[model samples]
Target: MLQSLEIELTSNKKQQPAADQLGFGNHFTDHMFIMDYSTDNGWHKPRIQPYQPIVLDPAAKVFHYGQTIFEGLKAYKTDDGRVLLFRPHKNIQRMNRSNERLSVPELNVDVVIEALKQLISVDKDWIPTAPSTSLYIRPFIIATQPQLGVAPSTHYQFIIIMSPVGAYYTEGVNPVKIFVESEYVRSVKGGVGEAKTAGNYAAGLKAQEIAKEKGYSQVLWLDGVHRKYIEEVGSMNVFFKLKGVVHTPALNGSILDGVTRNSIIQLLKHWNIEVIERPITIEELYKASQNGELEEAFGTGTAAVISPIGELNWQDDVLIINDGKTGELSKKLYDTLTGIQMGKLEDPLGWMVEATPVNV
Candidate 1:
């Protein structure tokens, strides 16, 4: 384990992007966090340096075998100029889970969280203060051993990059239409679906492309094997409000146990709302939708917080939900979560963490 964190400030800084034009993942911050790992030396050479392109060998294992893991989070600027991180510890823990599943070396949770704080502090000005805007943080580990063998690489690089992004939904939380993918299956049980890895996303690109062509915002993936059970909605965990109960799919090794998903469950419980976690079939959901039992549907994740589902197209049958508008509960949840995240509301759950500067 590396104890000392070396800091190298950038000699030349680029012009910052205007908050209004700060699209998602377009512009990067001035500095980034990077750490190297090897079988013999363990994790070492932790440093914060200028954001630049990484140089890896042409035969790197990540390029050939797809051994990489990543995690996404954000930092918010409060009215009083304090930088806040929402549930950053949860993301750090998930990053290690992804590393374990990808055969990559696990990161020290505390040290990695500290690295995030220090890195964000170094470039704290990059955090946007516009409405629903934030500095997106991406931490990833890639197999860099330049080996052609179909095995875990002996070397890895853990890197953290920051990008200032605007709100996910510009004109309020209008629901998005989802396309149910019948041809392409995302992941099955005992697969890498649960991990935040690059391969799982790579596998979804075809389906996503198809959905985009069909005039849908994203693809709602069902279970790969049975193709009946609802697994996840795009990159986020899904929820359906049927009758008066809220139902979300259980973590069955094939679905990502999202941080936002867990937080939403907790919040519902805190609010005394009936929430259940179990296997839900697509047919069941469709039947409920047909009978007008399904009141609202939404997807929860770090990016959108709450993306309400206005319609679901399965085999050309479009099921309009909540009158093709955002639900009241979805709006409330989004408002509360964003308020807490931006240090505007009382975080009774203690989810936000401040990245305080120490005269860096």
Candidate 2:
């Protein structure tokens, strides 16, 4: 039996006219879940309170040293009116992995799931019904100890907030143009690249801006040492198709193992798609594209799912792959993945977990 948790609710009385027009990470819900941690007390003072500005010292470690980690997942409403979450256990395990990398405390999986269930129960109406739209849940930890030292803080705060988001690309499902960064790198061998830390994003922002200015949608980052092998694209794991074989960069220390990436791998195996995880170089991709052997290219992440990449801008040349449109395999993966998420298909893997309801 699940124990009912205490949650103090302060509903947003004045409904904003723009609530239905929520873009990605644009609008937030009414309440948030919060818990504090310390070396002596472990995890304590768990509560669900109204959404408001958080107060923090100017010299907090998170602000100065960037000791922060975050996770992204969603809650969906089925056509039959049942609410479900897709593979939340994966997110919990990933959160623990990130915490270990960032020197934060690990949380129990059941406790975290229960706390999230209680939260979504209160804000269940926030889930959107639009195609590919859902309530995005963000769970993050920040070092709150107010000190200037460059070490990990003894105090931390873990919070989960909900936001209604629409599709990632508003320009339709067209393929993306990626800017290959031969100079700047997203991660290194002995760095915190694999962890979903805040600093990694802050560092990648400049490169992203440059890519945008150059008419590219995202940056295709490469390894730091020789810049010979591919790493990742913006916030996604990339895949390339050559000779009917699906090849993606192996999980080196720099590349993040995305949840969508893992799911795609599993789905490919289910379909008997020859998916290979190995090191891929821009030169090799260029050769394949030039030889007319490159069949398709795409990127996988939780936010965008499987976004097709039609053109690759390597150096001063642009190489177009596929039909300059979303690949057929990309559509299949997207449909199957979103189908399972929206409860439209049989959850063969038992990934969809029902949320506990709140009493009126």
Candidate 3:
């Protein structure tokens, strides 16, 4: 295990927001976890201090080369006032994968996980107890070396920030309309698509902006090479259920391996439902919709958990799924997952990690 982190309490605690008004990532807690990295010292100076603005050099490598990675997970306040983190280790592992891909220094997963537990314990009161509300945890790393070169930075900063968020999308588990992008591609094979890096999301702003103006909630991205195979939705992994069998795009070189997507697949198999992971083309999906084979469709991610895709507009050809409503399977998966998350259901997979309470 890494060294214990130094705790610095803040005297000024901001007024907590009402649970009903806690939208996604709008408010922050009073404290944050931070650690520094260097070639000589490795990762050191782990501390939990007041949440404040970070100062960086003008020519920091992160600003010039876009060398930053982030991971999202949540801590739920159970009915009994206990805080629980779902599948946090998996998120840290994925962060390491992103670091390797982005040429950033990998973090000690065990150390970071402990830091998260401690930080959340300190700010446990910020976890919202309202329905569908939780504290969103953002763990990120950035290259901080003050240089204007293309190479990876020798200095780095790993930080964990918490936000009391309600839902990622305004629809909040309701069905959402998606527009297929044929003009701009998000990422390509052998690119940083699989990595949870800022550049990947930055590259998608144009297409997302266009889709929003077109009255769509998100964009359904296709494969970069063929521009026909369905890769993923804007921030979630897409899934389709046809003829009682679930289908989701395989984790090819470009697509992200989502934790929620993997959990859904495991849940389906646990219930003996058929699930397949492969390259699914838009033509096949449209044909299935026409033949009534497409029964349900949804997207999985940490933010929304399971967002039902009610309609897909591809090149002006709109495909309304399940009568533009949430599907049965989608609702079931959402309930089960959220149930386990909120401590209402039995955790058969032992996915919940209890955050030990710390005296404030």
Which candidate number maximizes lDDT? 3
- Report how far residue 337 has shifted in candidate 3, in Å: 0.4
What's the TM-score of every candidate structure? Answer: 0.98, 0.96, 0.99
Model 3: residues with Cα > 4 Å off, grouped in runs: none
lDDT, each prediction: 0.91, 0.85, 0.94
Better of 1 and 3 by lDDT: 3
* Model 3: how far residue 351 lies from native, Å: 0.9
What clash pairs does model 3 have? none
Error of 2 at 119 (Å): 0.5
Higher-TM-score candidate of 2 and 3: 3
State the lDDT of candidate 2 residue by residue for 245-269, as single tens digits: 8999999888898888988888888
**Per-residue C-alpha lDDT of model 1 across residues 13-90, encoded as one tens digit per residue:** 989989889877989999999999999999999999999899999999999999999999989998988889989999
